[model samples]
Target: MASTTDVIAAPAPAPAKPPKRPPARKMVAWLDPLTLVKTGIRSAISATIGKQADRRLLDALAAPDVKPCDVSVDAAGRPRQELWLDYVSDLGDGWNSTYAVAETVARPSLTLRDETGATHETRGGAVLVFGGDEVYPDASLLAYEERTLHPWTCALRGQRPPPHLFAVPGNHDWYDGLVSFMRLFCQGRTLSGFETCQRRSYFAAKLPHGWWLIGTDMQLESDVDQPQVSYFQELAKQMGEEDRIILCLAEPAWLVSQVRPKEGRSYLENNLDFLEEQVFGKKVSVFLAGDLHHYRRHANPEGRQKIIAGGGGAFLHPTHLPRKEAELADGFTPRKIFPSPQESQRLCWRNLGLVVSNPRFGVLTGLLYMLLAWALSVNLGGANVPQALGLVVRTALSNPGIVLISTLVILGLMGFADRRFGRWRWLVGLLHGLLHLTAAFLIAWGVSHLMGSLVDLPFRSLGRDMLSAALIFVGGFLAGPTIMGLYLLLSLNVFGAHPNEAFSSLAIPDWKNFIRLHIDKEGHLRIFPIGLRRVPRAWKRGETAREPEWVADPRDKRATPPALIEPPIVL
Candidate 1:
C-alpha cells in the first residue's frame, strides 16, 4: 500500500494532471508606497475596532447564562466520554489544497474508530475550531466571501446535521475592523450552510471527557481588553480546581524564539500567564495556536505541550532546523512535524507560482528593462563589454562602504554555514558569498559603464539628445546601484543569518499541515499533527474513502521527517 510520506521518497513518480484553478489574482504589491500607506491606515484603525469588538464579545460571553456548546454527549443524554475536534488555522486561501483538506474534514465518514473497532459516534461530528487569519491579502467582506466562506460552503455541501463552527480573528481579520468576520461567524449568518449561532469572536465550550476549550482574542501587540479579562475572571470564579483546559491562542508563543520578543515583558507570554494563574488558576492541558503557517510541537518533561497548526491552508513556512532551541527563553525544543528537507525542496517550486503573474508580467517587465539597457549600449554608447566591466570595478573600488558591508555579509554567511554544517563551515560560507558578490558586481559594472557612454552619443537634435541622455542616466542608475541593492537583498535572504524565518522568495522545508485533538474518557489529550505531501490536485467532492494517512508518529521521539502510516480510519 502507498503511504503519505511516499511523496517525499527519492525519485518520486510523476504527478497526475491536476484540475484547473480559478483565475489567478495579482500578488499584493507589498513594495508600493501606496500599499504601505493603506496598511498603516488599516493598522491604526484596527486597534480601535479591535477594542470595541472585545467589549461586545465580553458582554455577550458574560450574559450570566451563556450555555456552552455540547459535543461529548449523545442524544441519549449521557456522557460519551470521548471527543474529536478538527482544528484548522490560517485557512483563508481558497486554493486547491485548502479545498481538498476542508472537504476531507467536512465528511462524516472521516471519523475515528477505537482499538476495539467500536465507532464512537460522538466523535464523528467533530466540531470546527478555526484559529485565526481567515482571509489573505487583507481582510475584507469580499475576501471573506471568496477565500473563506465559499470554500467552506463547498466543503459542507450534502452533509447531514452540520458541525458547529467557532473562530477568533487574526491580524488579517482585524484589518477590516472584524466586519466580515463578525458577519460570517458571529452574526446570524450560516457558517456550515446552516445559520451560525456563535455571538462572540472568543468562545468557551465544554467538551466531553472532562475537557474545556477557551479561545482568546489578540489584536496586534495590544493587551487582551479589560472586558475579555473580566469575562474570563468571572468564568474562573465559577470553575472547580479539578477541571483541565485546552487553551487556544491565535498566535503561537513559541515563535518568539525565531523573532525576538519585545523589550521588557512579552505581552503574549504575560497574557497566557495571567489566564493560567489569575483567571483559570488551574492546569492548562495544552496550548494550541496558529499564525506561523506551519505545524510544530514543543514539549517539556512535564508533559505540557505547545503546538502550532497554521498550515490549515496558507502558503507554507520553513522549518527552523538550525535554530538554537536551547537558547529560547522557554526551554522547550520545537519539533517540526512536516516537510522534511526533501519535501521542502519538492515544494519550493510552488514559490514561483506565487510571484509569476498570469501572463508572466514580473518576469517580462524585468526582461524589458534589461533589453532596453542592451539596446542603448549597442546603438548609442561606444563602450564595449570589457570597458563596462572595468568601469564597474573602478566604481566599486572607490566605495569603501560596499566593500565593508560585503565583508560583513560574507561573515554572516559563514556563521550560517557553521550552524548547519560543523566542519570547514567558514570556507564553504566564504566561497558561497564570494560567488554571489562577484555576480552582483558584474551586473552593476556593465550597466553603469553603458550609461556613462550614453553621454558621448552624437544626436542630431539638441532636445532629443538631452532627453536621451536623461533617460540613459536614469536607466544606468537602475542597472547599477539599484541592481546591486536587489542582489544584496537576495543574498541576505538566501544565505542570511536567521534560522526560523526565510526572506527568500521560496521558503524551503515549507510545512503545509494541521492537527486533530482527541481527549479520552480519562481526560488525557492526544494530538495528531497531519501533513499533506502537497495539495491533492485531484481531490473533489464525493471521492471514495481511503486508509487513514498519518504524517507523524506522535509516540516516536526520534522519527524521521515526513513520517507516514495507514491506519483503518481517514484523518
Candidate 2:
C-alpha cells in the first residue's frame, strides 16, 4: 500500500502563459460637437435648395391675367368663368409612378451680336412637357403628379415667363381626385381635370389664326364627369357657324379606333353602317391630342383632319402596323356620333406609329445610343434597322387605311370619355382600353402570321394564339394611371428600374430587418419565432451546447448533458 501511494503522489511543475487584451471587435470612436453640427446644417441647406428648385416652375406659372381660379354658376348656366387654355403642340403623356417627378422649365437668354460690336439679347420661351407616362397603370392623384406635374415642375418655365401659357389635365388627370388637383393649383370646380379650367369645360381665347379657339372639358363624366357631350353642345352654339373648330384633347378620342380606347371608348366600327351613320360629313376642321405618344395625321368626316401629337418625351409605347391584303372585315355596329350624321360607322382600325429615338429617361440612355450607333457601324445597314421597328412598319404599311381608321375610332371615343368623365372612373375605363390594345396587338400579329404563311409555312393556328392574345389584351387593360398609382404607393424604390437593386445596395430593407412581428388586438407589434421545428439543444452548465455523446466514464459527474433547455413546450 505504501509503495502504490508514493508512486501516485509524484508532484508536477507550473507553466507560463500570455496576457489577455480587450476584444478586437469592441473599438469605439468619439466625434467633435461642432463637426456634427456643421454636417447637419449643410445637409439641411442642400435639401432646402433642391426642394426650392423642384417647386420653381410651379411658382413661376403664377400669371397676372389668369385670375385667381374660382368656380361659380352663371346666368348662362356655365359652371365656371373663362380661363386661358394651355396647349402642348407635341409632347408625350405622364410618367409611370415611383419615378422622381422633377419637372423643370429652363429658358436661357439668347444673344444676338450686332455689327457695331454690340449685342442684343432675347429670352427664349421654353416649356418642358414632363410626360412619359401621362396615364399611369392606375388612376390616382399621386400617379397623376408623378406622371405629369413633378417631372415638369422646374422645366415648365419659359423665358420671361410666357405671357399666356396653359396646362390641361390629360386622361390620367381625370382618373385621380379632381378636387385635390384643383386644390393644388388653387383651381375650382369650374376648372377641374375632368372639365376645362375654370370654364364650362371649355375655355377660349383669340388665337392668331382668325378662327375662334375653344378648349372644352369634354369629359365631364369620364373618371368623374365628362362635359364632352355638353361641352360640345355648348361649343356648337358659341362658335360662329363659319368658325373652324380646333378640338384639343389629352387623348385624341375622336381620332383612334375602338381597339385602343385611351379614355375607355371606341369609335364607329369599320362596320360601314355605324361609320356612315356617325362619322360621315362632320364639321370638324381638326382635332388635336397627345396621349398616344406618337405623331400622326388623320382624316375625318366634314373635311376635318385629326392631328395626333403625343410625342412628349417619356417612354415609347409600341405601335402596331397593319396589313390590308389580310384584312378581316367584320359586321358593322350602330351608334350615334356627335358632329356626324352617319349612323352605321364601321370600325375599320389599323395600326400606325413611330418610336422616337430618345437620348435620356429610359433604358436607352445617351451611352446606349452611342453604343448602338457604334454597333451600326460594325453591322450592315440592313441589320441596322430594328426588327421590332420593321414589324411595326409592316403592319402599318400593309393596312394604312385600317390603322388610320382604328386610330380615329379609338381617339374619338377616348376624347369624348376623357372630356365627360372624372378620372376616378378610369378604373373601369382601363379595362375597356385593354380590350382595344389586345385587338391592336392581334391585328399586328395577324398580319405578320398571314405574311409568314404565304412564304414558307402553313397558316398558324388562331386557336393556339387565342390564349396568348387574351393575355396580352388583359395586360393592356391593366396598364393605366390607376395601376401606375398603385405601383407608386407600393413600390419600394424609384421608377424605370426594379426596387431590389437600390435597397440591396444600401444594405437596408424598406422596413426593419427580417423580424417576425406579431401583434395583439391593441395593435402593437411583438417579435416571435415562426414555423420552428427543431427542439433547442439543452445545456445546464455554462456552455453553448450539449455534451458529446461519447463519454469516457459512465459514473462520472460530468457524464450528463448540459441543460440548455427544459421542457420543450411553453406552458
Candidate 3:
C-alpha cells in the first residue's frame, strides 16, 4: 500500500479540454418500441454468445498474466490519516437526473446533518468509484462519451488535482462484451476530470488505515473468471488479520438469495461464497453492490455489512415488496431501506397511468391486437355481437399462430412474475394473459360493430374491413396499455409481484442516492448514506469562470438538496 503523500506526489497528467454541454435528454422509456427491441436484442445476444466470447478472451489474454494493479492510497506512518471516497452506481440516464448527481458529487464540500441532527462537513472524495451500469439502454463509445463522460467532465471542469475514477461492469456495460467499458475504463485514459488507473475491469485498492476496497466484475451474472479469482486470491495473501476488506460486486446476491432463493442461487453467488470462505476469509467486513436500483443495507450481529446503493440516476426501483426473511448468511434482514415502504408503495400508484407514462407500450399492444384480429378474420356484418365474440374465441383456439402467440404471452408474463411467488406465478400469468386475450376479442368485436353501424358495405368489402382494422388498432392502442398498467398496479400493490415492471413504468427520476465513506486515523470506517428526494429539473448556464457550465436553476420547485438517508454508521 502506498502512503497518501506517495499517491498524491505522482505527477499530474495534463488536463483535458472541457467537454461541451450534453444535450438535455429525457428519462429512458423502458416500454418504447425502439428501446425495448434494442435492449432486448443486446441482452439476448450477451447472454448467449457474448458470455462465451468474454470467457475465451479472458482465458487468452488475462489468465496468463494475473497481476492486479496496485492503486492503493494509505497513510503508513502518519499519526492522523483520513480518506474520503464516494461510491455511485446505475448512472447515465436522463440529463436532468444524471447532472443532478454529478454536480452534487463534484462539489468541493458538502455539509449535511443526520437524523440525530449531528452535522458533518465533508470534502469531495479523492477517489470516485462507479459501482456498475455506467450507461443506460446499451454500451458504446458514443453513449459513454455523451451520457457518462460529458456530464462529469462538465461538472468537474475547473477542479485541480481531480479525483481518480474506477468502475465495475454491470450487465448493461457488458452488452457489447465490455468493448466500450474496456476502452473507457481499463486503458488508463483521462476521463473528463478524473484519471483512470485500472489495468483490468476488476481492481484492488488499498485505502487509508487497514481497509481494502476490492471491486469485482462478474460478467453477465456469471461466475468470477479464473483470472479475477486468482487476482483477488493473491491480494488476500497480503492482508493481515486486523485488515478489513470492502468487497464490491455488480449485484447484491445476498438480497437476491433472501428474496428469491431458488432463482437467486446463481454461479455469481457461489463464486462470492467461495471467495469469502477460501480467499478473503473473515477479512471481508463489507459487501457493496448495485444491480438493483435502490438503497438497502443488511447487517448481522458480527458487524459485517451488506449494502446496495445503486440509486445513482436510473429510474427508481421500489423497495416495498414483501421479501422472505434471512435466507442470507447469518440470517440477516435489511436494517435500512430508502424511500420507506409506505413511500415506495405510494409511488407504485403512478403505474396505473401507464397509458400516459408509457404510451408507446400501448402502441405495441395495439399492434398485437391488430395481428390477432387479422389472424381471426373478425367480421361483424350480419352477425350478432355474441356470434362475433364466439367466432373470435373459436378461431383464436384453432389458429396455430394465434395459439402460439397466446402461449408466448402467457409464458412471457410468467417469466415476468416475481420468482418469490413460486408455483402461483403460472396461474397469475395465465389469468393475466386471459385478460389481454379477452380484451383483444372485445376490442375486435366493438371495432367491427362500429364499422357495420357506420357503413352500408358488407363485412367482406375491402373498404369496410380496412376501416374496421383501423378502429381495432385504435381501440387496442387505448385499452391494451391501460389494462397492463392496471394489472401491474394490482400485482405489485396487492400480490407483491412485478415490482420491477411496476416501478419501471413510472421512470421516476427522483430519490437518487450514493455512499460516501470516511476512514479515520484510528482505522475506523464511517459510512454516510446520502440521498436526494427530488432531482433538479431545471438548469441555467453558469456566469463565472470557476463554476461549472451548468448549475441547477434556483427557480425549479423540485430542486431539493442532498441529505442523510440515515445516521452515519461507524465501524
CA-only RMSD, every prediction:
13.0, 31.1, 9.1
Preferred candidate (TM-score higher): 2 or 3: 3
Show how many residue pairs clash in every candidate, following the order shown. 0, 138, 0
Report the Cα lDDT for residue 421, model 2. Answer: 31
Expressed as tens digits, the lDDT of each residue in 303-359 for candidate 1 is 667777787767666553333444443456655445554444344334334232112
Tell me the lDDT of model 3 at 297. 93
What ranges in model 1 sit over 4 Å off? 1-41, 44-67, 72-78, 110-125, 260-265, 327-331, 341-380, 385-504, 507-511, 538-571
| True-structure Cα RMSD, model 2 | 31.1
Q: What is the C-alpha lDDT profile of model 3 across 257-362, one tens digit per residue?
A: 5443454367767888888998998888888899788899988888889999988888998888654454567766678999888899889888767888888888
Q: For every model shown, what is its TM-score relative to the native structure?
A: 0.67, 0.33, 0.87
Q: What is the lDDT of residue 211 in candidate 1?
A: 72
The C-alpha local distance difference test score for the whole of candidate 1 amounts to 0.57
What is the overall TM-score of model 2 with all chains considered together? 0.33
- Cα deviation of 367, candidate 3, in Å: 1.9
